[model samples]
Target chain A: MRSHRDFARGFRESLAGGPAPQNATAQDPAEIERRFDVYRNNVAHGLTQALARHFPAIERLLGADCFRGLARAYIAEHPPRTPVLTEWGGAFPAYLADEPSLQSLSYLPDVARIEWARSRAYHAADSEPIAPERLQETATRAGTDLCLDLHPSVQVLQLLTPAGSIWASQQPGGPAPPRAKEWRPETLLIARRGISHVITSVVRSSTGRFVSALRAGDTVARARDRAGADFDLNAALLLLVENALIVGAGIETGDES
Target chain B: MTLPRKAGLGFKPEHFPAITETKPDLGFFEIHAENYMGAGGMPHAMLERLRADYALSVHGVGLSIGGPDPLDRDHLARLKLLCDRYDPESFSEHLAWASHGGVWMHDLLPLPYTAETLSLICDHVDEVQEHLGRRMLLENPATYVLFDDSDIPETEFLTEISQRTGCGLLLDVNNVFVSCVNHRQDPRAYLEAFPLNRVGEIHLAGHEEEELPSGPLLIDSHGREVAEPVWALYAEIVSKTGPLPSLIEWDNDVPDFATLMAEAKRASMILSGDHHALTS
Candidate 1:
C-alpha cells in the first residue's frame, strides 16, 4: 500500500499538471505531453465555464473568444479548491481588478464585481421576507430603535461606474453602456426576492449613509438622517419596497435597554 | 437484496417524462446528489415522480472523497441528509480524485493509490457509511498520467480499502480500459483479479483516443457510445462477477433519452444469463 506521505506527494505532483509519467522515453515525450495536456485542458475548461456562469455580464462584455481566453488563463493561475461550482471563482472579480493587462479596461472590474454579487445572490440560501405590516407594528412601538435584518442573499456593492447600466446594456436588445463620463460610483442592492436574484440601483448618497449608519448600529431613521441634505426618504423607502429587501426589524424599546 | 444484475442509465431531469412513460426495464437509475440538493424544485419533483417507478442510486460527484484535506464535514452532512431523503437502493463515490481544496472542482481528480491513500480513503468511506448507517460504493478512477510516487497497483489499494472499511466497489469497465490502455497495462489482468464479490455496481462509458506521433492515448470523455473493445471487457467482467447493477454514464454533450436507452440496451444484452454471486 502507498504510504500517506507518498500519497500526499503524488497528489501534489499530479494536481499541478506535472510530469506524472517519469519513465517516458525521449522518443515520445511529446506523446505523453499531449496526453497530459488533455487533462490540463479539461481542468482549465471546467474552471472557465464556472467563471462564465458566475460572471455572465463580464463574459458578454468581453465577447466569447476573448472572455474564454482570459478565463482559461485565469483558471490555470487560480484553480478552484472546492468541488461546489457555485462557490468557485469568488475571487475572480478581484483578480480582474488587479490584472495589469486589463488595466486599460478600468470599468471592467466593477462590472465583474457586480456580476459576482449577482451570482452569489442567485444561489444564497432562502430567507423569510419581513412583511410590510411588520414595519407598521415596529413604527408604533415607542423608543424602538428599529434595525432590519438584511436577506441572506442580499449584497449591497458600491461601484465606480454604472455597472448595473453596463450589465443591462450588454443584454440582448439593450443599448451600449454610457461611457465613464457617466462614471460616478453607484450603489446596487443585489438580492433574491423570491427565486432569482434581482439587481437594482440604489442612490449613492443613501447607500453610503445606510452602510455608515448600520456600522454605527443606529436606527433606520438615524441612518437616513446621515444621508445628509439630499436624503430622500420617499425614494429610498420605495426602492426597498419594490425590491422586497426589508426582512424584519427589532425595536430597541426602553425596557430592553 | 442486491441490485438486479442488469444495465441502467444515469438519470437526467430531462428524461423523467419519457422514462416514466416507457418504463424501460433498467436495473437502476443513478443521479448526482448535488443536483438534487435543492429543497424543492423541478429536479426533485421529477425525481420523486420517477423514483416511484425505478430503482434509484445516489452517485455523488462533489464529496471530495480522497482530498489531502480532511473530508469536507458539511459536505458529508449534506450527503447524509440526501441519503436519508432518497433511501436510494445504493450509493457510490469515486476513489481516484478530489476536486476541491477549499472549494469544489466539480470534476473527479485522480489520486495515487498508495498505502496512505488507502488508509485516508478507507477512513473517509468509513465515516460516510457511519453517517448514513449503510455501505457506500467507491468507484475506481481512469487516469491520463501515472504518478511516479505510486507504490501500489490500483486494484490492491482499492481491495485493501474495501477489506478494511467494509465499503463496496462501483467498477467502471470503461475506466479499466482507458486507464489500462493509457498506462499500457493488461485490462484483462486488472479485471481478472478485481474483487467482483464486493462490487455492488458497474459503470460503462464511452472514451475517445487522440493519435499522437508516439502512440494513441485514450481519453475517458464519456461523450459517445461505449466502444467494441470496452464491451468485450464488460462481457468478460460480467462472466466473472456474474452481473452487477450497471449504468451508462454520459455527462458531456448528453444526447436524447432514446440515445442513452439504446446504448443501455447493448449493456443489457450482455447480462442475459449472468448473475452476481453475492446478490443473485
Candidate 2:
C-alpha cells in the first residue's frame, strides 16, 4: 500500500495542476484521468463559489468568466489554510492589489478590502453599546484621561481610492458610484447595525483618524485632537452611538472622579 | 444523543427570514459545523432561533477524520465550543478527509480502505468523541475513483471503525448509490453489509451524472432535489432501520424554502410509510 503522506502529496499536487496520482484507479483505463478530474473540478469549483460569495462586488466588477479565471488562479496560488470559508478570502484584496492585470482598476483592491472588513464585522463578537449618558458622564469626569472602547465589530479602513463608494454602488439599492474624475481617496468604516446586517460607509477623513486612534487605545481627548479643527466631534460620536459601535468608556488612568 | 426520527432540511442562511417567519414543521435542521465556527453573527442568530424551535444536527464538514495528520487542536476546540453553545441533538462528520498538511481543500477527499487507514480513522473518531464528551456519527463518503492499494471493502472498514470506536454511523444513501454506480458495485449489497443497527441518521441528496466511456459516473453535487433512484434506495434503508433522522441536503444552487420543505415532506412520507408497515 502506498503511504498516506505520498498519496496526499500526489493528490494535492494533481488538484493544483499536476499529474494524476499514480495510485488512483478507475474500472476502465480510459476513465482514470476523467475520474481524477472530478476532485480537481470540485476543489476549484467549490472554492470559487466561496470566493464569489465573499466578494460579490469583485464578481460584479469583473464578469463571471473573468472572475472565475482569477478565482481559479487564486485558489491554486493561495489555497485556504483553514476550513472556515469565511476566513479564507482575507488575503484576496492584497492578492488583487499585487496583480498586474488589475492595475488599470486601481480601486479594485480597496473595494475588495472593504468587502472583507464587512464580512469580518458581520461575524465579530457581540457587545452592548454604552449608553449616551454614560459617554457624557465619562467625558465630564475623566477629561483627558477618558478612553472609549469600541464595539468588537468596529473596523476602519484608509484606502488610496474611492473603494467604499465602489463597493457601495455594487450593493443592491446602493447609491451610484462617483465619476472617475470625481473619485478620491476615502476612509471607510464598517460596523454591525444589528445581528441581521452591517453598516458599511465612507466616513470623513477626520472621523476615520478619530476612530482609528480610539481603536488603538488612545484617550478620548487624544482621539478628538487627532480629528483636527474641521472634525465634528458630535457627528463622530453620533456615528458611533447610532451604529452601536461604542461598547464601553473608561479613564486611561485608574483615577475615578 | 439522537435526533428525532423525522425528516429535516439542511439550513441555508438565505432561507433564514422565511424559516423564522413561517416556522416550518421540521424534525430538525442540520448545519455545517464550520459555518458556525465564526465568533458571532447572523449565523449564530439564525441558529439560536432555530435551535429554540427545532432539534439541530451539527454536521461537521472539515474534521478530516481519515487524514494522515493529527486532528487540528484549535479546530477541535472551536467545535467543542459550538457544540456546548448549541447543545445540538446530534453531531456528525464525514469519514473522508478535507484538510491535509495545513491546506484545506474544502472538498471531502477519498481514503484508501486498509487496516492502517481503519486504525487511523478509529483513533481520530475516538479523539473527537472524547474531546466533545459525546458519541458522533461518521458518514460514508462518495468516491469518484478507487485506490489500487485498498484491500478492505469500504463497508467493512466503516463497520470496523464503529465497532472499535463505538461511534454510530450516518448512512448517506446518495453516497452509497454514487459510489456503487462509480465503482460498478451493487448498492443493495453495500447496504446489506452496512451496520444498519448502528445507523443514527440517513442523508439523501442530488448527484451530477456524467456519461463515462465504461458507464455512468455520478458526482455527489448536492445541488438539487434528491433523485428518484436515490429515493428508492433511501426507502430501502428506511424499511430496514424503521426511520432514522433523514435529511434532505441541498447545498449548491439552493432552492427556495418551500422547495426544500417539499423534499423533506417526501422523506417524511417514506419514514411514516415504513412505520406503518412495521406497526400493522
Q: In DockQ terms, which candidate is top?
A: 2
Second chain TM-score per prediction?
0.94, 0.97
Candidate 1 lDDT tens digits, B58-120: 998887778777777777887888788778888889885555346444567676556676777
Q: Which ten residues in a row have the lowest lDDT in candidate 1 chain A?
A: A20-29
lDDT of 1 at B209: 94
Model 2 alpha-carbon drift over 4 Å, by segment: A254-257, B274-280
Q: In CAPRI terms, where does candidate 2 land? A: high
Model 1 - which docking category?
incorrect
Candidate whose lDDT is highest: 2
**Per-residue lDDT for A101-121 in model 2, tens only?**
999999999989888898899
TM-score for all models, in order of appearance: 0.79, 0.97
- lDDT per residue as tens, model 1, A20-130: 435322234556566667666676677787788778888877888989988877776777665556666878888888988889887788888877777666656565678
